[model samples]
Target: MKQGIHPDYHKVVFQDSSTGYKFMSSSTKGSDETIEWEDGNTYPLIRVEISSDSHPFYTGKQKFTQADGAVDRFNKKYGLSNN
Candidate 1:
């Protein structure tokens, strides 16, 4: 018989302990908005924006980034005439 040692638990329960917690704001909060707890501490409210949601990695959706002179740069680097 093998005996396991007791592990120390330092868990702090907050008013909001729900996963995927969403807050109603005008705009999305990118890991911002720190709320001071009763213990005089701050913590983040939301997590990943495009995780388990509408994202390219999860939903297999490809999003194109439109940048100025992007094709011109590629053609120049490949030694192709950008005419």
Candidate 2:
């Protein structure tokens, strides 16, 4: 709704190589670690340890982690210690 400030739209390559591109699992055998890209194609290969495949939020398996000092800090800030 406001002018003079906005995010710049940049060109991003989603899937560069569909022919020679393959999703190789790190825990599988005969998987080539090196990806041989085509010539004259300037595409970046980013390494990801985990994606949405193993994410807890997408898989509906998220767990709540309870911290020690979290409850104490919340009670002190909200004056819940009087009760």
RMSD of each: 11.8, 12.0
Q: Write the per-residue lDDT of candidate 1 for residues 6-70, one digit (tens) a residue.
A: 44333232222334433323222244445554566554444434443454665668776766578
Reference-based lDDT, residue 64, model 2: 75
The lDDT values for all models are 0.48, 0.47
| Model 2 segments more than 4 A misplaced | 1-46, 65-73, 76-83
Pairing residues by index, what is the TM-score of model 2?
Answer: 0.29
Tens-place lDDT per residue, model 2, 1-83, is 58758654422222224232234332312222334344443333434545555557866899876775788889988888755
Superposed Cα deviation of residue 16, candidate 1 (Å)? 9.7
Error of 2 at 83 (Å): 5.3
* lDDT, residue 1, model 1: 34
